[model samples]
Target: MTFAFDNAPVWLDLLGVFFFAVSGSLLAARKHIDIVGSLLLASLVGLGGGVIRDIILNTGPPAAFTTPAYLVPPVLATALVYFLFPYVQRYTSMLTLFDAGGLALFCMTGTIKALASGMNPVASVLLGVTTAVGGGLLRDVTANEVPELFNPKSIYAVPAFVGSAMTSALWVFGLFNVLTAAVVAAVVFAFRVLAWRRSWQAPLAVNGWQRRSSDPKP
Candidate 1:
């Protein structure tokens, strides 16, 4: 299937890039990093996942580096956030919303990119999850903290999985066109936001030792 360039997807991609960049910059500011450090972190958080996804898909150097639209947004977002730190700091929840939007957009975009590169549905879904969460994983690791996606307390990876699965399902149903992408993106974003609001999480199994204490021996 040919994925044509459309205004909706383009805007969605740019918005995702901008907000993820903002989230990274905000983290840097909280760490008391300099402007340069903030920009570096923001750009990495904005583009790192897409870079990894491209490499894994055997695509050339990342679009963020090759295309001005991809490169410029992160830089601009970082700068804007740096200058608007006070205002942003006052409403941290708004930043969370942006991050969720980024997650959804990236998940959808990554799935489409993988499909475009001739990957199967399963691989495409995995690629989508990777692209959605990879940058944040990189950011946390660089900052010397446990990545949120791996931590039990964080609800990060679940949203990516849901979004990716939805995208893949839509694609499999022959709805892999632009309109479907938009719908999937919106659905993904809505799910993430609702999950965040309600603190919805996946169930974890009790460890063997813990389970033994609660059960009687046969």
Candidate 2:
């Protein structure tokens, strides 16, 4: 069915890639990684999620590999960070914003792609969230840091889930157009950034007897 979104905005896709690449390069700066490593990390985080989703759907070679256009954002992002990270380092919150943008976008796009590939709503949602967080997982693992997806410090995956769930529901109801998708992405970005800023967290395991909330940092 081709997702019925054949005209999906190219700029939106590239914007997501750029945002994620910026975040990944910023992390490389924090870790004191070299320029080559920064470019690799940026590309990995920018394209890793889409590649995972495509593989899961049995699609042809991932779009990141097939489409040269997809490669540009990460390269540009890495270069920008490489030259300007010293000044950019002062704004730590920018990292969160970039990550939130990618998370917001990939969650929705991944869900719709899954649905277009004939996956059920539940499975689509799962893959969608996976697509949203897969890049950060790869970036963290490569950098030898705890993945935000699983880190107890932040409610990262939860926001991805919220976006994926909304996207799935929207599709199921025939409301998943370009405009609506943008709306959903916006909501997700806001949710994720707010969650980070407000120190919102999900409940944690409590000996399998009950769950308990993590204390939000003041």
Candidate 3:
């Protein structure tokens, strides 16, 4: 597969990375972490996904490292969030929205990059999903909590999956080039926002947890 640099989506990718890093830093602050921990978490959330994507694609040092812009955005975001911890706490809802938007954008961008690298459709979709959620997975694990994706009530991974698949499908159909991919990203983002607004969730298991009568009581 041939690799061609596409400048159109780079800015969007950076914006997403910035927001995600900010979100991570805010979480650290909520946990009353020190500046160093905040910066570390922010950087991990910002570049973790891209690192995994690049490794899987066999591309040289993750783009986040090679591009000074990528490095700056996340660092700035981390500092901004750390300094504005009080304000962030007061506006928790807004922070969640920003995080959702970032997830949607990263998923789409990852898929596009994979496709451009000449990966198969399956690999592209998988990479996109990974890029969207890998950082969050790392964050959750670092925080010693269950990953959000495994929570049946959470819509996080679903939105990313939809966005990545939609973008890949559009590419296969040859509609609107990369711009269409952006549209798909927007759609995924909108879905997440709406889901949050409405508290939309996956159906829960019905009567699947009925304790067996023979089981010993705790």
Candidate No. with top TM-score: 2
Candidate 2 TM-score versus the reference: 0.90
TM-score of every candidate: 0.85, 0.90, 0.85
What is the C-alpha lDDT profile of model 2 across 1-218, one tens digit per residue? 22366546355567778889999999999999999999999999999998998899987998888889999999999999988988878998988899999999889888888887899999999999998899989988998988988776688998889999998998898888777887889899999988888877666666454423554453
Which candidate model has the greater TM-score, 1 or 2?
A: 2
Worst 10 residues of 1 by lDDT: 209-218
Ranking 2 against 3 by TM-score, winner: 2
The digit string of per-residue lDDT tens for model 3 on 1-218 reads 21234774587678878877887787788788888898888888878887888888887988887888888866897789767777758876765776787788888778888888899878899899999988878877786666766655466788888988987777666663556756777788898887766656665577556544663333
lDDT of each: 0.77, 0.86, 0.77
Q: 1-218 in candidate 1: lDDT tens per residue?
A: 53563444466567778878887888888788888888888888888888888789877887777778987777897778778888778776765687777898899888877876789989999999999999888877877767768755447877788888888887777666667767777877787778666666554565443323433222
Q: Which ranges in model 1 have alpha carbons more than 4 Å from their true place?
A: 1-11, 205-218
What is the lDDT for 2 in model 1?
30
Give the poorly placed runs of model 3, Cα more than 4 Å off. 1-5, 177-179, 203-218
lDDT for model 3 comes to 0.77
